[model samples]
Target: MKEDAVDGDPFTTRDVGVAYHAYSASGDVTAPVVYAGSGNPSDYDWLTKQGIDVKGKIVLVRYSVPYSYRGFKALAAEQRGAAGILIYSDPAEDGFKKGRTYPDGPWGPESHIQRGGIGYDFRVPGDPLTPGWASVPGAPRIKAADAASLPKIMSAPLSWRDARPILEALKGPDAPATWQGGLPITYRVGAGPATVHMRVQMDDKVRPIWTVTGRLTGTQSPDQLVIVGNHRDAWVYGGVDPSSGTASLMELARSLGALAKRGTRPKRTIVFASWDAEEFTLTSSTEWGEQHARDLAEHAVAYLNVDSSTSGPDFKASAVPSLNRLVVQSARDILDIEEGTPEMLSNRLGGGSDYTVFLNFLGVPIVDMSFSGPYGVYHSMYDNHRWMQKFGDPGFVRHTAMTRLWGVMALRLANGDVVPLDYRASADRFREFIKEAVQTARLADLPALRPLKAAADRFAIAADRAGLRIETLLAGDPPDPAAAALIDRVLIGTERAFLDSAGIPGRPWYRHLIYAPKATYAPEVLPGVTEALEARDRKQIALQVARLAAALDRAAAILDGSR
Candidate 1:
């Protein structure tokens, strides 16, 4: 952990530093540090309206409610001409407000500083210099200055201990109720004498990253595949963040290897990968996904990701709706550590994992598995073995459960005669996404959503027809290989049809029209339409709705024909 402290705060050097990929201060930046609530654009806008401009001033923001990613906070501050940003965790967010803190319970200690990269990977993930393409041996590259995902302004993280002095020093208007944090001091929106020198210098360099892969070729069709992975890299010693999952991945690999030795291998190939640099930029996985884009598009059935396998005892999963049956089947087979009952699978996949590339970029069906609970030590040194053993995953029973669960999910896709992708749930979810966005944005008068709704309805009917056909084929005494192949193609095509080569309007690297990462790294369904609605740009909204409606129509037609 890099040490962090202010000139005025004379406590032990705090353990925090400027975030990865953020511009560092030239030397000591002695300036007035103003408080901006959550560092959101609206926060700055409010400051501007109140005649308190933030230009050339350092901003001290809390990691509080209305959860935008820290990178988004950095960008927001940069947008308003802030000289630098200091993001510190408020106890209400992930500290004693939750429960007893570290060394006592699962929450973070006063010293804990959440570490992470501030890169805008949601726009275009992977290597900044190699945006859309895979960065293999000699992949084409661009200057970091020209890269779309890189941050421009200086930034750093701070523990509340280090930030307390500065927050206490502020003199300004009382902050709104929502802007109050769990700190003892009263919150304020300031442009006062609370100025302090903020210094940062970084060693910005590109290092080699590796993605280790080993494929177990199938007996029936080696060309067909199922991919599974866990990211090996972590911000620190990521006990609950990734190492827990990494340990589970190793156990799963061993079990699978033993099965293969016994001459019981998957009918379709299983490619197991441990990706590097995932925590920083989600780099290695994205590169692998891009490098094999063509092959994956043609033959890949599903991707299973294991991340944070056990932080506590609540079993959870995130997946595309199309994989509901597969997830349900796998859950029924695995035992939950808490109740000793069948594990439960949660809802739609989010945007920040290795699966982002597979599902959003390559249109592969994906499921991300986890066992979560009070995980406040995320991205910190506190997330080490002791924390995991004492609080996260005591007895490591959950680890074994994860191993079995991960293997079972991968096997279901790899060994099944027919690709186990179903689109009925997907269609339902798509409609819900559209309706929620329209209602939330109150864009009921928007004209184009009518076609989008009709297209979604048609797609649902088509999905039912396709499901019926698959059921009959699976029930066949011996389904015709040619017919089964065609059905599988349609099933996979349903997912691929969601892709628009031009990508979500501004962020083309994220080609999936239905799902893409929001600027805050949250999963955005109907991303194109959702973003347009946020802008309240009717013409752009209409264009996005039409593009999505066309994709839905294309998916429906494929299902209709297969039936």
Candidate 2:
């Protein structure tokens, strides 16, 4: 609170103030703040069995339990019947030994609070009114009550300054070490022998979502499309989580748009989207893509996601393996980092922010562009303009760099003689998926297990065979147009192969290779079919990989023959 700490920037101080303001405005007061322990689905059931009504009640829960995002399950609890949810981060997990807190250093301070929605479920994401289909204005709307699911309203952070008052009031047995936190008091899971009350009221109103788009139409294959996007929204002054990355995206758009204006249009249409509601689980883009699903699948060459960038020590990318080489080539052109390979930069798919809908449901080959700048101020009041300016990107150099990279990749995809989708890499990745499929099958019921395993084995063989052929084709030379188109179509078919028209167990709208059960903080609501379908889909995926591989091989043969 010192004058010098203000740093002469109004946004920095304002962001800090805004963080406190959000906490004060959203906190609940009337209901007894009972502890739901971990806040999982089973916890909800246990509370019900104990005759404790969570509906119309304010529940206080801790973060860093079995589930990183407690809001997801808690929101589902609210739908089942709970009034308000308050999630506080225990000091034990993210404080002290982890490093210094904000103002002191980077990690969240004692007073810092993490505010987020409990709206996103892993099942699917988009306009609630139109589940599987698009949400066009005149589209028939599903009633809110009839809507598939409800997320509990909750927020969290790594602080005891914000948690002290609530934890002091609760009375219960000593918490297990796993449940214990850094707080001075003996941790206890309580429905309150002390009996604190909590109350919450939200506007529950829909806000206008903005999606700034710029298009570059290709000359040779105008209908074939390639899209790249980044989100602009943040919890507070999200200088790190989104703004940093979004700025890069805007730079890319400017660069690409400038190129088109200069009469250097690509061969396929390229679009850039600055999406809204990404913090709330990709609400804007998912709805837009879902609405335009058919058209998108038909024309979409690929979808690239650029999110959460910073002046990092390193650059990382997680993309559909098929595009591994392409991403690497592009990144090396733009960045100075030595860890140059796309395969090196790329990581696995897990829950956090965007890219869920595109890859999980729609089957769009998604590439998550990430920049890990230090993890000191993540989800804290310190994650403001000041932090970014000081430790992040002061000169906006990285922003400019990423923009250029986006332009290069978009141009490559749009203007290439053939959509450069490499199926050998795809086949190789599918083979890895077979291992995951078997793991999934092992978790299934006995009746479904054998069939699933059989399917997985079949897929494993197909993927291995096809992957080898595709690699051979690529190693040789470029392929004929027809063969290339076949490869492209086969890549496209991989996405559709995993979709079940019947949808996930509950929510039907999301159909893709992976399953994302809707969760609050982790809201990429895509559901893969049951364990039984795992093997079957595994096999189907291999077949699709093979199909693309064969097409690419044929194309290579034809190109060689012609030569």
Candidate 3:
């Protein structure tokens, strides 16, 4: 409840303010600390074997471990009894000398600290009070105490200024070279002579989350929906991460709104969302998606996301395999950036933001876009409008550029009579995956590698033949209904192949291709397949490729008006 608890002005407005007191923390406290390396749940195995207990202790976890998510979950399990949580950046990942520090360069200064949530266990996130539903007006809610997955105590962050004293006092094993940071003191993984008191009692107060949605209904296929979203909140002066993207979202809205006002409505309904609670692991979007899971699967066409936009030079996209080409062409048609082409800039997907819920859980095709190169000042006090003006897109020129790009793509998707998803490009991506899968299986000594390889070659040839036909259709005229439906359904099902009812090793909610699925939704998977554990994933992928080729052939026949 203190004024300083919520650090900056941007956090006050709930949507666009700077100070966010989601959790309680202290910077100046001196506490006896223990280093848990990556703080991973697996690390507990090693710690317990050494007879070291982290319960009733303050934990120091280094950032950028192999699996930070797993590490955080382990720390939270300890927090059911831990005194506090202290997370800091390791010099090896991103610290002084690797690059520049802020004001002087792009790296964080000594005072910079990393802050994040310590609860949820990669299962679900929100006001632990509300799960699987919106925290909207008059909604039923559970008490934080009854919230089984909630963290018992609040977590806070400390600057290296505070980290030095605690670390220096410790007397224990010299930390692995990989764990060493920029501090001159010998990094010892410790439980320490660094004894001091630490305490945190967070008020699990409920805060309102805003989801600003604006719609432009299409004239023809109004039932099909195209949604684009970006978060609008910041931890500090979040001008680059959320605000930069937030500004672009605003520009996109204004541009579309202007066009709609001129009677240029799309052929399909388009919804633009400015989400709250994205920084806290996409709470708002995920909860909303969970509440509407069934309806979204039935009606939604595609969801595109733009986060962390700045004046950075290169643009990158991580897409679900289904929309790979559609996303590529749109970026090419929209953005002016040149670096082996935007298509080449695309890469394998990972988890960080809102798209996880839609693609991972609901099986919706998604495209995530952002431009990242150098911004040393992320998640710190310096991530303000001034830093943005001086170092990022000053005066929002890039906002206009991005708006032009987002606008064109949204327009085409929302207005086109036939969904222009290029199945040929999709098949190409599948072919590439087949090649990689074959290599991986050979390396792993898995059987049937040759059969998979032969099947992939046949699929590739079929794809090439289909590619020529689809290209001719694009060059001549849009495909007919039978063709369009065949292509669209195959596109949807092929992308959905990554979904397994079994989900990931620990988390069942993430059933998507590239990221972790949400916990509340049922896994999307192929029907009638024998549910056998230990079946080769490469086998499943190859099977899906063959099915996709068959669907494409059927689509070509339909589009040619021969069906």
What TM-score number comes out for model 3? 0.77
lDDT of 2 by residue, 1-563 (tens): 11123345466454344331121124465655566766667666666676666665566666653346544645554665655666766656555546775455455556556655554445556665566666666778777656543443434332466567777777655545655667777765565654554434445555567767778777867777798888888776788878888878777767777777888777788888888877665677877787677887677878888777764646677777657777888877677444354345543455555566666666677677766654545555567777776666667666667667667777777776556666456545544554454455434333433443444344445445544545555564564556556555555555445555555445555554443443533323112423324445655444433333333343333322311
Best by TM-score: 1
C-alpha RMSD of each candidate structure in angstroms? 3.9, 6.0, 6.1
- Give candidate 1 misplaced runs (Cα > 4 Å): 1-28, 65-67, 336-347, 438-444
Q: Assess each prediction's global lDDT (C-alpha) against the native.
A: 0.81, 0.59, 0.60
- Give me the overall lDDT of model 2: 0.59
Candidate 1 lDDT tens digits, 296-333: 99998888998678998888777888998777767765
TM-score of each: 0.93, 0.79, 0.77
Winning candidate number (lDDT): 1
Cα lDDT tens digits for candidate 3, 419-532: 555545545665565455445443443443344345445545555564565555456455565665554444434444445545544445655433442221222222111111
How does candidate 3 score on lDDT? Answer: 0.60
